[model samples]
Target: MEKTPSACAMQWNIELERDLRSKKPGKSIEAILDIGPRLEWWSRESNLHAAEYKIFGLIPGEDKLFANAILLRLADAFKSGDKHMKICIVKIFLSELKQRRQLRGQGRKDEGILSKDKVDSYRELLTRIKIVFDSGNIEERALALVLFGCWAHIAKDSADVRYLILSSLWSMHILEAKASLFAAGCISELADDFAHVFLEMLGGLLVSSETSRTIRLAGGRAFAKMWCPILLADIAHKTGVNLILESSEEEFSLVMLVSLSKIASKWTPLIPRQVELLSSFMTKDRGLSLQVIALKCLRFILTKGMYHFPANSNVTLKLFGVINQLDFPPALHFDALRVLCKILPPNLDTIPCTEILTIFSKFLQIVEFKLQSPVISERVFAIHVLACIFDKLLGILKDRSGIGSIVSSRMLTFTFDRISY
Candidate 1:
């Protein structure tokens, strides 16, 4: 039911950008905290232009306001089972983003907002959202909880608030209210949608043996609380929509992956159960996808436990089956080898030289892809692992294989090679 945007709103946005960014004193990032929600609600009512910017301009700067807008619109969509509203909201955001970029080209400092101020704003906004979770209609509450998880990763103040909200939903069993969302005589198509993501995230963050045990205990304890059973399995599980590829934004995914990887040690044992129950997802073409997820999980496990871990070598070998079974594009192969290089004892598996060269032949793609991080710290992980191989390569080839060693050098000359068809 979203309407088309008026010329005025479009112009207002442009003016707002110009007014805020062109100043010497600078604009308050908190001023427009709620604009994202307002624009979204209006866009869902039918502004095609509003709808476009609703998603486009709104997503990056949304903070708490963005979450509110999403919650409100999702509630509305749930009540009406309206597809147009979803489409409208997304379109508006995208369109707004497109417009913002156009304006940026002409000199506008996008929200000029500092991350700290925005996180502070989101905390207050989260308080308001919790009230909605308890009293706003059930569908609205459920939808709010879903968004809580999505925004939790990005929102600076989001950690504790996100966990509590999701925990409260679990303890309360909001999904059991059974209000039932239906559009075409079917039950609500809306589901937790964010649960799998948070779960995967939780899995990724488990880094240490101590954290691993704690996470399983925490996950089990959390899920074990069952005031109601058949209708659910702790925290409102999204029974309706089959979750597949719902989350894939590059920047966001990377953020979630890295953070979760930090906590991956806690998630390992908890994963088998999640993987087992969600058996339907184990399809044909998805083999590669699953392997990627598994290896990434394993990589996360090693990265976290590497320092303090006592059984580092055994953990590597036990998980070796998972890594070796994985089917990555040749691009990822080198890092897989590099990861192995981190834990592989010089005397155990294959000769260090042959292993280094063999993996270097394959894993250069990982090196090339990972080398682009602008942050000195972020690039360090790859460099450190690649260093292990380079040390061995240098020793073996400094006298024997100088040409081969240069190809594997830090310059990453391999990076410029595009995979042309």
Candidate 2:
């Protein structure tokens, strides 16, 4: 004479409502969940219900405890190798919330407006982890990441935007999905910690080689979005070794690196990290065949001037060392000339033995015939760098012989020929 599990859940929901209305303090989630005899079978559905309750009032507040509780539950699901549970939480709950909002429109007829239950659910989440950030521990860090990932919005004045997002600096996912969502009023919550957890999961995947493809690709896309923007302008830069190592296809590696360069273009300062990562693809990993793509991106990032991308002597010199060892597609040499213009100190062309300028000078004419008109986009890029090199070369025309002479003769003639309308 056992009650069916759904029947029991219905009963518990009734009792829980009674407890909530009575405003009782002793009511505990554990005690309620334990009410069923075969709790294991009912636990999954019950856990979902706990997460979905809307308890918080508007002017939503941060909750650390609830956030932790949710994360712990999710982590447990992951630990148990429960794919259905993981997909349910990540795809159905976390990701699908945003998707629902997209369908619902601002008024939310599609998914319906946030209910009292939904608001309270979020409030509980924020309240639990509220003060732990200042406490300083790995748990706190994890707590911060979860809250940030789950709810922190980037909208400037929205009631939901909890943190000042420097995410455009380091998070690609934020830039692509979150930025647009925040701006359009489509999304008001962000779990900023997804990147950290994702990175942690990725490292685990790298070690175990058993992680799902969904996890790897989604995780990488997430990291690439957030971290890409931050590495620009030379503050605390590091090479993107992940691109070369994680991406099996050389072309995919190139596409990713090129995408990084495109993001770096609007930089508030010079881009040194771009060079470090780009150098990894140079010469040796032709299979990492992104030079043309990377060059196009580099050209765009450097549209303004050589001064835009300030040099890291270490990265630039390493790049030169790599350049010295082998030959590349002549198109790459041309693009390298453009990158060198920005990163090198003003008179780097004067460096003896093997500066970029020397390579260009010794071989500029040699490769001239091979450097065909780039594709329309490529032509646009080459134009941008040509403008930069032309400006700088004009200044030192008297001191620099080969480049200035070639520019005076062949390049200026082309500009005039193309523009005479």
Candidate 3:
């Protein structure tokens, strides 16, 4: 009887293992070359998992010959196999790289260092990936951008590799927005030598009215990952403010806000400006979705750098205005209350009686309005917010000060009324 395809594949896996165990690099390489076509065939048949598992399983000892074989097979897969095949090969490469990194961390210095042969094999793989990048369909090119970025991270110390990666950034304009995003994401790894050039490039894309929202967001994320002070300053001085106040696109505003939030811990000098921008979104005129995102960004900024929040009364009153806007969606209300909770000090002694009364009155109004809501969830949410407010200000509420006495009495009346219901 003719051997089934699975049987043939199994037989090939067995022989491949034997050759690897024989401890002869020449024999193992030959066996890998011999099985290359079979692996490609299996990938085409959508049975790549078995062959991939067997091959990876047999090569865990950092066998140089196995590494070469894997690279060669990767090239073959990219050249002829389907998209799934190419993706599987890329994942294997990444997984192997991660495992090697872990080994290095464990003090396996020899295994961690890239030998000359290993570097050469990676160079060959990069060449093949670039070829696909230049000529492949959009999906393939997007995948290639990811592979290129990973290669940049792995070969970061090499000047030649850095140059190659930088050269790809110029071609980003020709690619679709999604592909360009992948390329943008890779810039953080190359920021040491090429930060200024990339900053100008990414910054231009971020602030340009003509740039797509997707690309703007991509640039924002890239800046967030870099954590460079210069980049952060540029974002604060120009890109973020432009998006927040000038751009009509809500998504662009949201992307910039998110980017700012990620770096909020280090953005003390610009906290007031950020608060001003976020307050604009919290107004009744803005869309609910944008308001919600603004509230979240505000919360992150307040929680991470509360000491930096501007001490101005205008800023405090604007936040109070957010909670008092009963017409806003429940989500906005909840997030706004959360932001208020973050900004309010646990020890309220530093605040004056009039300011505390202002805050307490606004929150009391919110609780009163929400309690009367016909929706059970709204009432529950009100209870939760009230509990949070009480928890946060319990110290002052229990004090003998006149402000505390007034707040305590009002809270008692509300709590008793809810219980009676």
Q: Which candidate is the best by TM-score?
A: 3
Alpha carbon lDDT of each predicted model: 0.38, 0.41, 0.59
Q: Which candidate is the best by lDDT?
A: 3
lDDT of 1 by residue, 156-251 (tens): 234454454434422334241111110100101112333443344333332223333333333322322111222333222221111222433323
Order candidates by TM-score, high to low. 3, 2, 1
Model 3 agreement with the true structure over 204-318: per-residue lDDT tens digits: 6666667665666666666554445645454544555664576777776777777766655455766676677777776667876677787778877766645446435565676
lDDT of prediction 3: 0.59
Off by over 4 Å in 1: 1-136, 146-168, 171-260, 264-294, 300-335, 344-421
Which has the better TM-score: candidate 2, or candidate 3? Answer: 3
- Between candidates 2 and 3, name the one with more favorable lDDT: 3
Error of 3 at 270 (Å): 6.4
How many clashes does each candidate structure show, in the order listed? 40, 41, 0
What TM-score would candidate 2 get against the native? 0.40
Candidate 3, superposed: residue stretches over 4 Å from native:
1-72, 79-84, 87-121, 134-141, 155-177, 207-214, 228-238, 265-276, 299-320, 323-327, 345-347, 373-381, 387-394, 397-400, 416-421
Point out where model 2 deviates above 4 Å: 1-198, 228-243, 246-270, 296-307, 311-363, 370-391, 397-421
